[model samples]
Target: MKDTAKHQGLRNQLVKLLAEKGIYDTNVLNAMNAVPRHLFLESGFQDFAYQDTAFPIGAGQTISQPYTVAFQSQLLQVKADDKVLEIGTGSGYQTAVLCKMGAKVFTIERQNELYRKTSVLLPKLGYRPRVVSFGDGYKGLPNDAPFDSIIVTAGAPFVPQPLLAQLKIGGRLVIPVGDEKQVMTLLIRTSETHFEQHEFGDFKFVPMLEDKNR
Candidate 1:
């Protein structure tokens, strides 16, 4: 929970690394630097938290690499106070990033263990989202639909229709789509019945499961 000067220095280096990788969003970078990522990991893995690579957290999940988190956050184009839906809340790292940027986030995690742990850890660190759920995310939080943007941290074989339907007109949905490997895809709602889609490069993610546990 303590963000020592040493931790801040490491985060500064991480920010430069992210900038070199072509992430130019100052808001996103500032938020990244502000959040002490080391606090989000277990003590044993804390030292590597600032690295540009993913590390396993329990329950078959991995906290996304800093680059990935920044990349996705930038692509989502989050405006302050935008209501965003995050499909996976592993480690609550990305959730913290969005919250630091002042987005009202609604996140869902299918792993009960992860959901339970993060549900508690986030607030303790002062990164509270609007809602966190222990349920399948494929259905897309209908009760809180029409999000300004939606970000899926886990890999999905295809875009879930429910997620598309949940987006407000002009909202964006950022997701990785495919199996084994995924193409980073972005969807922007253009009208009541249309969405613009684009794909950029590739990434690997734990599959976004259909059921609570499978």
Candidate 2:
């Protein structure tokens, strides 16, 4: 019961942080609360899980900040049982949030070490999303095409055409875009040939690399 108590405390802290930061969506808050942020961090960093900062998980990658995760998830507007594509699995923290929000997530990781680690950790945490190989996240998951939503955790120079093509009409893609500095962007598929894009202010993220696996 000690673990359960700790989880509850973390959840309360996350809710308080979200409210303080103006994350008003109940769904996003609940998902943030449901997922155990501590599980995604190194053992030594468990105490810092409730803080609003990115923490390293090796392989030069960091688990994204809670606000970033909540903002992306909220922008995607994921519905229960929706199929969502995640570009970078990282430490699987965002993946866990997606799963908790009721998204059927298909995630890809470019770093082999991080991929292997998250693959083992996720199932152990009871929040496994479908894991795929490393490559250009811009390509997205085609076999699972026409997804309900797509989220890219890394910052890209531009929205990849292939990902836009994979979005079902009315589906949304939430990603960070720009070079060096980035801004969170939300793209909505209006029709087979049209899209609407919105910029959601500045954010920093690791550059989205191509073919890190090769």
Among the numbered candidates, top lDDT falls to 1
Q: Report the lDDT tens digits of candidate 2 across residue range 87-198.
A: 9999998998899888898998888888888888888888868655566687787887879899999999998999999999999999899998899999999988989989
For candidate 1, which ten residues in a row score worst on lDDT? 205-214
Report lDDT per candidate: 0.93, 0.86
lDDT of 1 by residue, 140-201 (tens): 89999889999999999999999999999999999999999999999999999999999989
Per-candidate RMSD, Å = 0.9, 1.6
Which ten residues in a row are the worst by lDDT in model 2? 1-10
TM-score of each: 0.98, 0.95
